[model samples]
Target: MNIWESHRFGKRIHLTYHALRRMEERRISLDMVQDLIEKGTLIHKDEKYCWIFKSYSHRDDNLVCAAVIRGSAVVIKTLMTHWQEQPE
Candidate 1:
């Protein structure tokens, strides 16, 4: 696992063993997760990329990937909605 110097949630970010297991299953890279946690906006809920100095991503080379860094192994909690249900 690649360890990155990243900042996490303002307070405590709780994660679960099951979440970690899910991440592993999704094949989401740790570096990508680090980019999420270290950078992105929390409340904005924007996709494409993380928020490092108000950065919004325009790159689409990688779409099916999502990540978050920091927290106690449980950094992400996603509920795939209708949009995600559609075929690209």
Candidate 2:
């Protein structure tokens, strides 16, 4: 199954310990994760590509999700957030 299928709320998603830690560290909410999976633009796709999207929060931080679909599960490898620099 692809990452989309594996990310179904009813389906199973396996977040690696590192991913979980990163999410927590970045204050990423489950809603943000879901938003990325559902609405984020796919920048690239190999085994998987980093999903880039704005966070659901008001801060609108840029979120990058790295995940791979394994069997019936979506294994999230890591998550990162960055502030977009405003152009003058």
Candidate 3:
């Protein structure tokens, strides 16, 4: 299945295929994503997507980010490390 559900902080989060692949490639685990969803800061958000960023003690990357489309259920669009904030 391209979409799967994960629970964090009693909220249902859905990961898209692209998000899963990026997670694997970036070596970001499901736990990391869920932790981020629970604890990360909301950096930027528009009508289409919301970006969450957090620093991990185990990782060297300054920050890990998840791009999510929020609704009744949050759909994680992708994940990234060493994220540099871009201007809108």
Give the Cα lDDT of each candidate. 0.38, 0.58, 0.80
lDDT (tens digit, per residue) of candidate 2 on 1-88: 1233434435666667887788788887666666676666554455544444554546556545545443445567777777342334
Tens-digit lDDT string for candidate 3 (1-88) = 3344545534468888999999889898887887788889876477667898999988998599998887777788999899877877
In order of lDDT, best first, we have 3, 2, 1
Q: What range of 10 consecutive residues in model 1 has the weakest lDDT sum? A: 78-87
The per-prediction tally of clashing pairs is: 3, 0, 0
- Residue 27: error of model 1 in Å? 1.1
Q: Please report how far candidate 3 places residue 12 from its true position, in Å.
A: 1.9
Model 2 worst lDDT window (10 residues): 1-10
TM-score of each: 0.37, 0.60, 0.79
Stretches of candidate 2 off by over 4 Å are 1-11, 45-52, 55-57, 67-72, 83-88
lDDT of 1 at 3: 30
Measured by lDDT, the strongest candidate is: 3
**Which candidate model has the greater lDDT, 1 or 2?**
2
